[model samples]
Target: MEYSIEDVAAARSLQFAKYMYTSMATFWTYDYACSLHEEWTFLLRSHWSKMKGLYIATRYLPFILLITNLYMSFTPNENLVKCGMLVNITSGLGMILAICADCFFIIRTYVFWNKNKILLAAIVGTYLSFVVASVSIIVDTTASAAYATIPIPDITGCYQSSTSDQIFIPFVLFSVFGLGLMILTLIRAIHSWQRNQSHLYVVLMNHNILYYACVFLFSVMNIFTSLLLQDSYQTVLDGVQFLALAIIATRMHIHLWQTNQHLRGSSGLVHIRLSDMSSVNVTA
Candidate 1:
């Protein structure tokens, strides 16, 4: 049997999305496996705290999402309503996952600034603004996502008939937020360098800068793809981006905890203990 050009394109796009899911599953498996020992030793053995709760959520929520997304892409489902509902569920979860990952930056930066109230206020204010705006935009745009049953050759999943261009706004907001965080971190990084040139200080600085750079790059890539592409292609980077944020953020927390425990740090670095990092009083 023959198919129309549009049908062929749709099939190819769905195929590409399947490839994306395959890659995400592969990466997630490898990343989670490699970190299991660290998680058991550093996280499971540690005392509980609100910060630990956030880290656990950030680390594990994506595993739930990965399962759902796999079901969406690979499983045989033709109900448009179910497809739309799954999309909404995943999108909302992804937004929440993003905030969870971002909290690490907020907490770490607050600690990096030596828990200065003024700097903490500045960062928290900007972050809350971004959060409010992104929540409003994502809620509005997610409602606009429409799906249809794909009746074409070689396609097993429902096709995303339409998604709002405004969906890109959240990515844009996040990119801006990430850039600001990186800027603040770099500025403070200079002060840290001059204040105390300890090995612990160098390690912390290296982790922040390098990981922030990676997250920032992926954010930009997401913005462009979400803005320019349509249908399945629009979200090709979504899984990888989320995984990047999760893996990098968790690594930052774990490495810091281990460093603090082992080195006990010089005067410069010891003040920023892992337990105290997330105790920033945003209300004050």
Candidate 2:
């Protein structure tokens, strides 16, 4: 192979062009993920207040964090943007929601247990740890002010490495804790159903378990995909997560409505049957 100086220069230029194209593609996919996040957030917000306030808050908090993450990914002025503050607010609100849910579950479990203080305490303690971990993540993310000067390493965006590590550690811990809690809840529900077998209770409990399980599993998978795969893969993951959540939630909501209607009809029929029986006896 004979190559002139011009040929060497041409090859180098081609390689550079390819590298730039790849980088641009990754950035595009990353931006697309942010857009999807915003889209899903808006959809969920539109449905807010339909369920209890808890549902409204749970959907809102994560969407807000998704927005903050989107902003950080797009912005180049690391020192001028208050992105870290946004993250802090998002995580803090999320932690509050988690704690509230924890309290609600603890109370329900206590009532179901006939005020077993020990079991209640254990469950509460475990959830408290979850809340604490979330709060720690909030604190760490906040420690690195969005407007503060931070080193920008590569095209991945601006982040203070030291503080980010602290933030990530607590985030991982909280996620793990959440997964464990979901599993425990599922097990407890199964046992409760086996003991008494109330159809209504069982149905509700299973729906609740499935909802939490999807939340934990998909959320973890989304995070993992974002961290490990190329940015293109992230776009795919974002799409998958959004569609999965939407489909599952919608289905559950529809089924709940149907179940309620059926129950109401059954109750009415029972009332009519008792009335007819009483009327016949009076006639006799």
Best by TM-score: 1
Runs of candidate 1 exceeding 4 Å displacement: 265-272, 278-284
Estimate the overall C-alpha local distance difference test score of candidate 2.
0.46
Model 2 RMSD in Å is: 11.7
Residue-level lDDT tens digits of model 1 in 76-156: 547777877877787778878888988877777777787788988988898788878888886777677677655674576
Alpha-carbon lDDT, every model:
0.75, 0.46
lDDT of 2 by residue, 37-66 (tens): 544544553334324344344434444434
Query: Against the true structure, what is each candidate's TM-score?
Result: 0.89, 0.51
Candidate 2 wrongly placed segments (more than 4 Å): 1-51, 59-81, 94-117, 144-163, 179-183, 186-195, 215-258, 268-284
lDDT of 1 at 229: 74
Model 2 lowest lDDT segment of ten: 275-284
Task: Specify the poorest-scoring 10-residue window by lDDT in model 1.
Answer: 275-284
